[model samples]
Target: MNGPTILLVDEPTSALDHERGAAIIELITALTHERATATILVTHDRTHLTAADQIVEIHDGRLHLPAPAC
Candidate 1:
């Protein structure tokens, strides 16, 4: 509650190996939930998409947002 409300991470794990990348993702996820902070993760890595609650895809210079989860 004392930290910034929004967290922006760009290519945080780009230079990391699979295991290390996953660890970074896990740490971010934990912080996001624990702090109740909104997180925007910008990356081209599809492997980490599973950690997302919503997925946004940018293709052809357009943004595609997923349907609301029900």
Candidate 2:
């Protein structure tokens, strides 16, 4: 039962050491693209953030989009 899928991972890399964390993030990203699945990776690491196609930040219970440059 699979065509396209979605993965909602919360703090998925937080527990691992640096190398393992990076590896895990890479694995997740690879699987998402390879399987054509939509992945919502919830992480505080800015390094992993770049791997996302789009990013939504939340603060004080509010969602924030990137602000327009002046």
Candidate 3:
């Protein structure tokens, strides 16, 4: 009733500077939890993994299922 509950973000900060990029990630994670929505963020930036409930990595052209957080 509020809005779309699922968010898919692919390289949402690809064109931004590091500071702005981090801010964007922070906003995204906050909104995801605040709205109780599912967010699928596909990015090469592994630093944002802490915000994810599950993480899948692509290795050798295959998707490796969610691995234990490092």
Candidate 4:
């Protein structure tokens, strides 16, 4: 759980109910901070976006990022 760890969790909350989902997310976030591990979470849920340090959205095999204003 520590020392150069990488956690690749896919749809971790997909099967959980709302309360459980939130709790799981909180636990994972806390573990990331406590263990200082690199966590890569993959999901289609936008609600978890705010918890991420960086957001990379992929659509139609392409990645999207915020574009500069004209």
Best by lDDT: 1
> Could you tell which candidate, 1 or 4, scores higher by TM-score?
1
Q: List, residue by residue over 30-63, the lDDT tens digit for candidate 2.
A: 9999998999888887777877888889999899
Model 1 misplacement above 4 A: 68-70
lDDT of 4 by residue, 1-70 (tens): 3366888889999988878988888888888888888899989877767778767778999989867559
In model 1, residue pairs whose N, Cα or C atoms come closer than 3 Å (at least 3 residues apart or on different chains), thus clashing, are: none
The residue ranges of model 4 lying beyond 4 angstroms of the native Cα positions read 1-4, 67-70
Predicted structure 1, TM vs. truth: 0.89
Q: lDDT per residue, candidate 3, 1-70, as tens digits?
A: 5677899999987888878888999999899999989998999877667767888888899988965658
Question: What is the lDDT, from 0 to 100, of the residue 39 in candidate 2?
Answer: 90
Candidate 1's displacement at residue 46, Å, is 0.3
> What lDDT does model 2 reach?
0.86
Q: Candidate 3, 9: how far from true, in Å?
A: 0.4
lDDT of 1 by residue, 1-70 (tens): 4689999999999999999999999999999999999999999889999999888999999999888879
lDDT of candidate 4 at residue 59, scale 0 to 100: 92
**TM-score between model 3 and native:** 0.78
User: Which is better, 1 or 2, measured by TM-score?
Assistant: 1
